[model samples]
Target: MANTIYFDEAGYTGNHLMDPDQRFFAYGSVVTSDEEAKEFVESLIRRYNIQNGELKGGKLVSHHKGRKAIDEILREFHGRLLVTVSDKKYTLACKLFEYIFEPSISDINSLFYGVGFHRFIANILYMEFMARGAGAEQIFDEFQDLMRRPDDGKLGALFSASKHPDNSPVITQIREFAQYRAADIKEEVESLAESSVGKWVLDVTNSSLHSLLAHWGTKYDVITAICDNSKPLQESGEFFKIMVGNEQRLKGGFAGNEHPMTFNLSGPLEFRDSKTCHGIQLADAVAGAAVHVLGGGTDDHAKRWRELLPEMSILNILPDKDELDLRLGTARRNVVLLNELHARAKNGQDLIEGMPLLIARLTHRLNLPPIPRPVG
Candidate 1:
């Protein structure tokens, strides 16, 4: 039987990621049959003696006994669980880097993206802004405004922020890129303003669901995704099809090592109310638990939940401790380069000067040919 996957999210403040209240966003899923899903909810209610007609993960994780109930669900649930989490500030930084650094030329972009250059640069931008502390808000706000409505004034302010004299290498790199390569950024921003794609880029809920669907597609032959009534998923019938069916090309990998696959979506995505769907309720619990843990909740109840998460079968998108290690050649190093960039961001070191080294290491990770340096 085709698995029916239920989806829900927590800490979704739309594209306004600068909100201080919720610094993280999470999307969660529970995969199982219709009958298994219904029984799972019933069992939770019967076990916890839930009086409410529906389960709310937010309310459940706020108290001692409530948290225990959620813990039990995480441990004892029968269905498979998956979740993706993002730091809202970091996500905004990613959007900024994509706008500013992504190449416009298709052929060059393929090679850069193939080597994971875009992600590497985005991480650098994120770390640099993070090191700036309170000063980062203006840049973030200006970029946020620009994303909402493209304007020359907002664009100029953002570019000017990049030009600010900072000893940080990332900042210096930004200045160079903006002055020499900024025309492309301006053109791309203006182009995106004419479409809805720009706004959707920061929608963690939308992006997470798309990622989750792609991951699920790899494992299951056929899937019926049952999502909470999210406007994006509801209207994204064709978009979901493309994402799931592998219409979007995979990021290029080493030839012969590429393992291409496609998702078998049984039909159109089904949106339903949480009140009536036990599966969605379970998904809500999973997402809520993930956000609480990522948000650095300090109480014993929160701590207990944290200990349980590593044991659960979940796909976490958040960067972990290994990704923060300062060593470039750490055995744990991967495509993300989070470790190196973070160390540089903290010490205000220069990544621009290390471009050749970065390219070499990244290419090594993919076992690809040497990436040529740009000619002056």
Candidate 2:
């Protein structure tokens, strides 16, 4: 059966100097059985009052009140937020590497594949801990040993050193958490493995780019990442919109318009921009509001997805041109100019006249500074 894998990531500052341990990279995917996808579409239409005749720019109906009410409506429409699982051991280890080695962000990006592989290693360590009833510290040590001898098959040494008894309650709790986390992780991973189309979204906040490259690889049908447009700069607020655009193109299908996977990265504008706004809609808005009152994009919503699937697709339904232009003209214009300059800037020649002044004006107009650095 064909499936659509919507992915997004959370954590990991794009800045390389940032400690990886402080970052928590997450990827979440929602896989709909063919039948379920159809049902979801129908639910969306009915709940949002989406109609052929409905004007495209009208206020979309939502189940909740206030600014983010759409979150509530989406939850009421979609049933459950099925997710996949992955281990955080590698995520932790990567942070250790970053802390100890302190590689540039670009340098780490180059080792993307290795970073992802580390996460798998972490997953393996987690499993070992659960099976053998080990403490977090013991697990850490075993993980270190595995890093030294990645080829080893037998884990008898690690298991023998565990602190808890086979039937201890602590072991039970760890096992339960693992099982629960695994169910969610499996849902997301299986979607990627099974899908013939769709993209994966990732939250890069508190995460290393290496983590992503290792898991999914650098080459795919389409891979788009969303990052803070300008933090150290001036246009950070628009980062979310920029990421949405990239994800939209993937969702529309890149390549010969036939590729199966679409990858996305999202997060808070102030954070690493790895949290998927799309997944938030799915988990909290669509699933939470519809199935459980607890479902909605709150701190809990962010935390749940962050812990479960740190990477997932970020689906953004942009506002109409008129509204967007009115709200973000200067920032949008700068993005366009940045692209043009990137393509045409010869040698070290300045792309725009009075570049500093232009950026300052954009900052004044958009109320954010340090325009988003373009992805090469």
Best by lDDT: 1
Which candidate leads in TM-score? 1
Candidate 2 residue-wise lDDT, 150-220, digit = tens: 33442334323535554354333333332323333233333434442111122223122223322232233
How does each model score on lDDT?
A: 0.66, 0.32
Model 1 scores a TM of 0.76
TM-score of each: 0.76, 0.25
Worst 10 residues of 1 by lDDT: 329-338
Q: How big is the positional error of residue 184 in model 2, measured in Å on the Cα after superposition? A: 34
What is the alpha-carbon lDDT of model 1 when measured against the actual structure?
Answer: 0.66
- Cα RMSD for candidates in order: 6.6, 23.2
Superposed model 2: Cα runs more than 4 Å off: 1-117, 131-241, 244-282, 285-376
Which residue ranges in model 1 land beyond 4 Å of their true spot? 46-52, 104-106, 114-116, 133-135, 151-153, 161-169, 243-261, 299-301, 307-376
The 10-residue segment of model 2 with minimum total lDDT is 53-62
